[model samples]
Structure formats: C-alpha cells, structure tokens
Target: MPRGKARTAATARKPRAPNLPAPFVNGTILKDLRKKEWKLGDEVGKGGFGLIYLAAEDVDSPVAQTAEHVIKIEPHSNGPLFCELHFYQRVSKPEMINAWANSRKLKYLGVPKYITHGNHTRGNENFRFLVMPRFGTDLQKIFEGCGKQFSKETVLALGLRMVDALEYLHENGYVHADIKASNILLGFDNKQEQQDQVYLVDYGLVLKYSPDGSHKEYKEDPRKAHDGTIEFTSTDAHKGVAPSRRGDMEILAFCMLQWLCGKLPWEDKLLDKNYVADSKIRYMEDIPALMRACFSKGESHGEISKFLTLILKLGYEEKPDYNKYKTLFKDGLKKLGVKDEWKLHLPVAGTSAKKSVKRKSEEASECSTPKKKVRGTPKVATTSGSLQHTPKPAAKPRQGTPQTARGTPQRARGRGTPQTARGRGTPRTGTPRATASRASIKSPMKGDSVNSPQTIKSPAKVQTVKSPVKSPSKGNNSKPSTRRKVKRSRAKKVDAWVQTSPR
Candidate 1:
C-alpha cells in the first residue's frame, strides 16, 4: 500500500475521546469575557451536554450550596454549549428582558436573564461556560410528584406565562424548539415571593426563524426529522420542517394538554414517529374527537379545544395574535371562578400561594391599564354590536316562553277539544324551562368541572333521577322527572343530527 493509504487506515483505527468537560475542583475561580470572576462551588447536577456547578462572584470564602448563581461547563469542542452561549448573548440579556417587560406592561416575564459567559482552560483541555441565576426544581419533578396531573387552573396559568415567554423569544427572532416539563424551572431560591414565576431554560435547541428581519422559508430536511421529544413534538418537527413560531405554540399546547389530562393520545405510539405525527394531524383536524379521546364523555375542555384550533390555523411565516391566545386562558380562569394572579397553584406538589415581589414605582406605572386608542367607526360599531347581540339571544329564550304560554291557551280554547289536548302540553313547555334552569346552573361548571363539581354531584343526581317514580320522594320527583325528560330529548336530537350528517 502507498504511504498515504497506510496513514489513513491507522488514523481510522484510533479510539476517539468522549466530548465531556472534566469536573473542576471546588473554590476554582474563572473570569468571564467581561473580566468578571465567578467562583465555582460543588457540582450540583448534570445536563445533556455539560455539568452544572453552584457558582458565585469571586469572593474570599467558599461558594455556598445556596449560591445565587450557577455555571454550566462543557468541553470547548462540544457544540451545544456554544450554541446556547450565543443565544444568551444575543437575546437574553438582563436589560433586554426588563425593557420588553416594561414595553408590554407586564408584571413579570419568565425568560431567564443571561449573566455572562467565557472560555476557560484547565490542564491541557479548553472548556466553555455560561453563568445564569440559579433556579429551583424543574417542573418535571413536581409534575411526577403530583401524580402526573395538574389542575386546570395550574395548566392555564402555566400556559399563559409560557405564551409570554415564547412571544418574547419570537419577537427577538428565536424559536425554542424544545419546550417540555424538564426545561421549565421554578424561580430561584424557591422563596414564597418567587414560586409564582417559572423560567424557560435550556436554549441549546433554540433557532432563529427570522434573520435580518425576514422570516425563514418553510422547508423540510429529512435528516432533521423528529428533532424533539417524540410524544410532545410539533407535527412540523415530526415532518423535519425547521421550528417556527407556530411550532413553538404547538409544542406548548401539547405540554399544557399533558399537564391537564395526564397523558396524550399518541403517547403510547411515540416509538413510531410517523404514527405519532399522523395521529396529531388527525386530531388537529377534529379537535372534538381529540377531546373525547382524552376526556370522558361530556367532559371536553373548551379552552384547550379553542387553543389547539387557533394554533393549527397559523401559517408557516405568520405572526400569531398573542393577546387572543391569552384571552382564551383568561376566560378559562374566569369560568373556573379564579383570577390570573400570576401565582401557580400546585396542590399535589404542596406549593402555597404567595404574593410576588413588590413592584417599583416605575413598574407600577407601567402595570396600570393603558387607555384604548380609538380606531375607525366601523370597528367600534362592530364591537358594540357584538356585545349587544350576546345577551339578547339568551334573554329571548327566557322571554318567549311566557308569551308562548299565554298565546297558546287562548288559541286552544278558541279552536276545539282536540286543540285543548295540545294545550294541556304544559309539560312540554315546562320541560324546556327546566332545561334552561339546569343549563344556567351548569354553565359555570365548564373546563375541569368533571374533576370538581361533577364528581361531587354525580352520585346524588344519578340516584335521584334513576328511581324518581318508584321512590317516596315528594317534590324532588318532579325535578328529576324534568331532568329525565330533558336528557331523553337531548339524546334524541343528538342521534338525529349524527344520523343526518355526513360521515
């Protein structure tokens, strides 16, 4: 063999070293690119591509376990940390987050603030490290500890905050391709004032959808298909398309669904990427069926259905209406009789509600509701018309019953005895009235009513309605009979509609 061929063969047989950073000793100090020194403490944890260390400013003493900051380190040759470092330097500066929050009139934003990053050398190897504020336990642990299910309130609240975070990233030209429970972290120190806030961390998979003020064209690469967590990844990701704003929202919707419903429909078939993607496509096309598959009959979540429907309609390069998405969550919380206090309530994890940090006078001014700018007359007219039309339909149903009752009796008496037989149909009119009352009572029990009020009322309502005639119950039998009539009528209508509609 020639000398060049022999050399290539020898090199091919050589063993490669793993791409990991060597652990540094406690009390080691390293200076950042800005020449600020940060002292490393004990090794606290490990990441997918690096080691996490408790860190603090270079000081006279040792770094404490309760250090206010952490440093993630990896070998210089590793690409993940370098990519994350650039993301932090470009989009996550402290001033940028503060400015965005102020401009948006928000009390708190969940994007983790970037501190500093620099290169370091130890022995003969070079390493890269980035510093950030320390965070408490990740959401995954709490999710598991809570039996893998979060309350509806918690799910909506988390979703609202995540939307804020993702909006901030998208505005700044980045997409968080990997959003999952493991990447969401509670605020630092786990203090009472900080529990309400959750930071979106781990930007290693972050991509810039828009560069130089132009959105990237939609294209798929077979090599990059199925690029994120299999079960929760967006269908776009499953198809190997580059992550975009819609992809981020789609991933977040899956996360919120899993948090509320405990699992997803395609979770069982996650090993088959194409199957999972196909299932998501089918469900997106028919959100009601998706809700039925996840929830029991008559227990569908309207808010989640609406959210999924809106995001699935987004085009590849289209900007999302962030405020509309927020309204969906806010309305859901309102139906649940709660306000979005920006505090997360994790009952299974035993997290108590706590007041957030006091706002500065400037922040208070920013938080005040802004005056609405008057738009065109047509828009204002449309808004008022919608508001006026909303209550009219509900009121008409109530008002028409009395008029029908009075008019029917006069007509029946004027006609004949056969007409009188139809007039004695007071029971028919009474049944609709009963249904209206029941609907009024049940309207407040939307969203997760199944896990709450329905659980409490189901047995009693079922028993009372089952044997109303045979039981010795007096006036109670009348109410149950009306309810039974309403159920039968509704079932008949549903059967008729289903049979008449196309398959």
Candidate 2:
C-alpha cells in the first residue's frame, strides 16, 4: 500500500471499510512468494477471504522487479467452507465468462486477466484461494472519489456497456449475483478503446446456469445459502431464489441507477414502509404493482424515473427479447425528447454497436496490450480511529410504530419528509426537509453530444431526519445553531438524511 497521512485522512472521511483477515497476518503469505517476493511487494489490499498483494516483476526474474502483478487470497476457513469454494471454482472456470475474457477464448468481456490460484492448509483447516493481474483501483474507490453523481454522457456510455455485459452473460449461461460499485474496476482506457473503461470485477458469487437457462446446484454445495453483497442483491436474491438472468439484470440496474437516483427501490418513502420491508425480500416480479405505479410520473424524476422503471420491469418481468425491444429501448430514449445527445449504442458506443466487430483472437501475441496505463498500487487502507460507523437513530417510537435501532424513524414522512403529505402523520417537529432549488443549480452547461443539459452530479438529494432539533432560544441557550437550510424557488423538494457518529 502507498504510504502517507493523505490516504489515511482520505479514508477516514470516506467511511471506507477494507476487509481484514482475522487469523493470519499477510506477512506469512508474502513469505511463500520468496524468490517472487521481491517482484510481488507488500500487501496492497486485504479482504474477508484473504490478502491482495502487488506482484510486478519480469518473466525471467519474478521476485526481484518493479510492480507487475496482483495476488488475491481467501484465508483458511474456520468451519464449513463449501459455498465460497464452490463460487470461486465455478466463476473462475477456465472456460467461464471470466476466462473467455482472458487469453483462453479471447473475448474482451471487460474482465481482468487471470493469473494463478492456490491455497494453504493449517492443522484441520483449509484456505481456498485465487490470483489475478491487479491494475488500477476498482470502481468503488473511483465512485467515492467521484462522489454520488455522474454526467449524462458518462452515465449513458457506461450504462449501455454494463447492461450489454449483463445481457451477454445471461445469453451464455451464468448469473453474476453480486453487482456493486466495488466490483467494477476503473482506470486507464486502453489506448485502442474508445475511452476509459469500467470492467466488471470480483466474480465472488458468480454461478452457472443450465442450457435451458435454469440453475443447476453446484456439486460442491448448493444449500441456497450462497448469495451476494447485500447492498446489490436483488429481491429474488434476497428471497433465496436461485440467481437468474433477471436477477443479474436487477443488480445491474441497481448499480447503474444508484448513481442517478441515489436511492434503493424498496426503500422509497412514497409507499407504506411495511409493504416495502416485506416486499424487499421477494423476487423482482413479485414487487407490488403500486411500487411501479409510484414511478408513473416521469415529470417527478426528470426522465430518470422512466429509465429506473424500465430497469425495475426488467428485473421483475420476463427478460425483454433483445431482438424485440432493442430498437424500442433506443426509441424510448428518443421519445424522452432529449436533443443533442448521441444514441449510445446499446452493445457499445453507437459506432461499435452498429458495426460488425470481430471477436478478439485467442493468441495473446496477436492482441496487443491496451495502451492505457494500469492503475498503480493503492495505498494500504485499514480502519482509521477518527471514522466510526453509525446506523440511523430510532425515531421517538410512536406507540404503534416499529423502530430501527438508533432513534431515527423508518419511512416517516409528511410536511418535512418524503413519506408524509403536509404534516398528516408527521410529528410537530417533523417539518418538511428543504432541498436544492433548481434555480440554484448551475444551468445546463454546453458539451459534446454524449453529455446532456440534464445531468446529475450527486446522489439525488434524499432527506432523512436524524433527530428533530429544538429551535434555538434567543436568550437562554449558548449552543451554536446546528441546522442549515438552503432554499431555491424552482427545484422540487428532495429529502435526504445521513447518520454519522460525531467525530
């Protein structure tokens, strides 16, 4: 990891968490690389499974060289360890999607190049493992750096590719159950490619599908226990339904749309919290129609809501025969009446999408390495002392209200929140939370066809009341005012509240 207080301070402000091994120190694994140790270098990252070390070296003398490669580790399991192993072996299959993107089959599936995989055993326990060429940082880090919003052209460009990738996997026979910002990697745009690329990373929960597109349990262990990152898991995934193309699409939509709306579908305050809470665990198709209805007003979302509805429909309904809706999806964007924006080709950029591009050849020599520079080693990040994780405080629980830990209310809205309609059930103190006025936002800036005037730069503003503050007294109080309000006459009200344990 890079050394400095800069990274330390940055991580503290970011609420970032890097998985640390419980039993083993990374130094032990560094020792195993011995001659290769000089080439590998120190630990770049560590996770629940194991450690990811940088290994930059020459073909002849691997250990004693500059940074060259990366090794990801899954430390030994303490007890039953079937799911993790099954998942790793399944997705890491030489002929699987990941492998196809590598040298074996020669498809640029936008995945990293695979290295080698192995594990170490201690006493009665066995540790499963794998390795890959580590490059620039993953998207989670990039998104944190970029913050909650992305420009339209940037989003459209990225959105089309990710969806296309998901569609491709579904067509082949696999489901990448875990799709989150962390699993997407971003760095140099290969010089030969159109621009910077966002390759899919971390196939931790990837599983295979039968020829009929149905799931076949892995012989290693298929108890329906294995799933994916909770933040990205689809309703079907949460319900123990086997991962499917639809589920994968749901995850893809979640990953892309989160950048736009900055809220989860099931967490919307527009509906009864009870329904969402219960429904959040069902399949996408099982989501209540009312939830879809809430999105009926495209005006409220500025066209973004319509795209999200499509994603929700894709997640819940049957996969649209791409053949049937390919042009229709394109037309929907056109119908939005967005002007000056180029049609981002669904499979690639419009140019690549329309042209008949040949698949990459299998010979590694035939294909030149992308000219884009690979990301350098990341500064090692461990939990810092200044930052603390906190959940929302429970709202003063109403006599009949259910409460989440911490005193914050769940889905409580009204005059001051999204859930409440003009103080109806809202507490006296729960005044509607004010939001950014459209007038205050910088008017649409002119740009290339890729970027449009209606661009979102941060997570859509969401308001959550941590605790109602007593209006400050003019004479008896000495505490400085803690509330802040910025009003704009033209924008719609957006409510968002974040919980943080004071530093």
Candidate 3:
C-alpha cells in the first residue's frame, strides 16, 4: 500500500464506541442520490442500527417548503434498510396501496408511503437512507399525553384499526414480527381522513414468510424464537418457531391490554424471558379475569374478552376469520348503544362540549325492555313522543338484569345471532386467581428495483434474547436463572439473526 493513501484511509475512520455506528453529521448534503436536492435537518430518532433525520428539499428547488419528510439512514455497508427498500418498492407502490385501501373501504391504509431511497458516500464510508412521509406521534407518546391509560372504547377502536393494518400486510405476504404500541403512529396532516388514521411503521424487523403466496412450514428453530420485542412477542416467538398470523394477533392483544391497564403483567420482569412466558400463560388461561382487571366493567370489556379468547384459540398456522374478529368490536359498540364508527369524535378544538357514552350499567333497563307486538301496522308517531306500536297484548314484565362483579348490567337471550350474549351474563366473582407473581420475559433477500445490494457488516454483540412464548410449566420446572443460562449456552452455538434496525 502507498504511504500517503494508507494514512488518508486511517484518518477517515472515526473512534466509535463498541456497538455504536459513526454518527451522521446534521446539514450534510447527500449528493446525486435522488432526483430532487435535499439537506438533512435535526435527528428525529435513533435506534440500534440507524438514525432517523428530518429532511427538506433545498430552498432553490421547485418543491414546496411545506413538503417535509423523514429519512432513515444506516451504514451504507450493511443493514436491514436494504431489505426494507425492496419491500417498499413492491408493497408501497401507489397502485398497490390504492388497491389495498379500496378493497378495505378505508380512506388510507395504515402504512408509510415510500418516497425515494439511495446511498450517499462520505470519505471511506457509505450510508443508505430511505425517505418516507413524516407522521405525528406514536401511540406510546399519545398514551402518555392522554394519561397513562386509554378508555376501553378508545383501546378497542385502536385495536380494530391495527387489525386492519396487519390483515392487509398478512394478505400481502408479510408478517410484522414486532407488534407494539411504539411502532404505531398517528397521521398529522391537515386532511381530516388522514388525521383520523394510524400507520404501522418500522419494517426493519418484518419478514416475508409467504414470499410465493404460501405460509412457510412451522419448524422449531430455537435460535429464531423470541426474535422480537420481549413484552409483547407471541408464544410461537418464544418457542423459536416462525411467526405467523396468530403471532401477530397475540402481540396486538398484549398491546391492547397494556393500553387499557397502563402496564403489562410482565413489564417489570423483562430480564427473565421464561418468567414472562409463564406469566403470559397464566394470563391467557384466564382471559376473562385479565380483561376485568384491565378494562372497565361493561360491554367493552365483554367484547374484548371474546376477541382475545378467539385469538388464543387460533392455530399456529391457521388463517384467522378477520370479519368475525372485527364484528366483536362492532357488536360491542351496538350493545353500548354508541355510534357504529370506530373513532369517537372529540369536539372541535375550541368547543366546550364534553364527550360521553351511556354505560352498560345504565343500559340495563333499555336492554331488558321487550318489544311490544302490534296486530296492525306500527304507529307512525313522529314529531311528538307517543307509542309507536299498534295495540295487541301488552308486553310481559321486563326481565331481571344480571350484573357483572363490577355492577355493569348484561343482556340475556334464549337464543340469538352468533350467540353474542355468551360472556355477558353474571360475573364469577369468586373464581380462584392463578399465581400473579410469575415473571420472565425477520427475513431475507430477493428482487428489488430501487434498493441495491450491500455487504453484511460484522455481527454486533448479542444482547438479551426475548421469549416468544413461555413453555407451559410442568410438574417441576428448572429455576429461571438456570434455564436462562442453558438458553444462553444454546444461543452461543447458533448465531441469532440480527434485527438490523428500525423503521
């Protein structure tokens, strides 16, 4: 090597701390990368694999100043951004987005639209960046802003929206391995429809399990189990099995519970994956009780219980009945006598009108009041209040309303549609509770039109391994510390797939 050239190469390398990459300088111009000129702004977020920056088109360019976007950049040498770039090229296409949205009868899909992506060179290093529309805040931040917990109705509404997004992704041959509140962002545009939307972002950990339109065979790969966020990962994830439709629903259920209760049962025991796993088992074993602890007593709680129980019953490889799950939330709204729409309208910014809904307890009489039969056509009484039914035999006396432990009234039926009245009966207040003290705690390749191939970087040091599912405890189980050590030893034998980065 030439002396002068070698010295220049040595000088270009920055002294980086272990595991952290070289930081990208703000205001740095990435030249010839995209059609339009862009200059970087402040760092909006940082993660294990890359940094996210606010980007604006240069002043002299033809674009409007109001058009702001977010750019996610990782080392040009290697990262998951390369994988994501290809996904956006296919899934985020304008026509494809429109098709999915129209099929679902939604104003917009809950996914970030890809703008442009390319690589920028700086001295001896290259950095890859992807530009996407900027969004408001994540559900995590909004949860904090609205107080630690969300109302039961609000949580159900959010769950319904998330299911829509996940269903779209699953149908499109992808699985969102990481499903949590932090990954969900609300839109902030001036358009009302956009403002009412929530998007699932950060596809770095996503996997294309059904690349060719069939779900991959489920096999236990201990190394791959529990490859996502610890607290909300699916049981399949814990077992080192590949994530599927059921896994996504399980994770979403955890998010809903946390949003309602303000914390998860295993939030404090994050370090012990086995403990967390066992706790989750106990949670699923008694879904109704968990719902009671988290959600307020009412139709909302009953509906949420049904939704989760159904999710729990799903097979590891089974396709879910999306409409049935959606109907659970819709039926809850009907029973509560609220609007059929998922979103509750907050009064206009300056208005003093308070938002409220009738409680299930208050609706007891209304639900119990039987309809009177008429011999002739029903009365057409309109403007003025009067009996609507033609006279026949007077209706029987109202039936007694059964109440939940928390005093929420429920409806009873001899038989009804879909048997929706199953869990709304009297609550079992004296059921023995399980042990509440238990603790514990993507993919590859192909194609592409926009993203170019890059070399893989050296693996970063292994951090904590998350449990996707807690194995059911047997007669005598090993201690958590001992079990963790065994898992760690096994992990050392097989290299864990790197998460790469975030959305």
Which parts of model 2 have CA positions greater than 4 angstroms off?
1-39, 57-66, 78-107, 121-126, 187-195, 211-227, 265-503
State residue 235's C-alpha deviation in candidate 2, in Å.
1.8
lDDT of 1 by residue, 166-277 (tens): 9999988999999999999988764322668898999988999977688887776555667788888887776667899999999999999898888899899776666787
Model 3 regions more than 4 Å off? 1-21, 31-35, 59-67, 191-195, 292-300, 340-503
Tens digits of lDDT, candidate 2, 1-503: 11111111111122124344444442344323223432344677765455666554343443422354566655454221234345434444445665445543322455544445555665665554455655555655545444444444445545555665566556556667887777766533332222355667666556665645555532211223224655566555444456767667666656655654445565554234224424444423433443344344432333334444555555332554543333433444555554423332222223322232323343443454432222211110111110112211111113223221111122221112222221333233222222112211222223312122122232333222322333232453435434333233112232221121112
Residue 444 lDDT in model 1?
A: 20
How would you order the candidates by lDDT, starting with the best? 1, 3, 2
Counting clashing residue pairs in each candidate, in order, gives 0, 38, 16
Question: Model 3 — which ten-residue stretch has the worst lDDT?
Answer: 434-443
lDDT of residue 177 for candidate 2: 80
Worst 10 residues of 2 by lDDT: 379-388
Model 2 residue 379 lDDT score: 15
* Residue pairs whose backbone atoms clash in candidate 1: none
Score every model by TM-score: 0.65, 0.46, 0.61
Model 1 TM-score (2 dp): 0.65
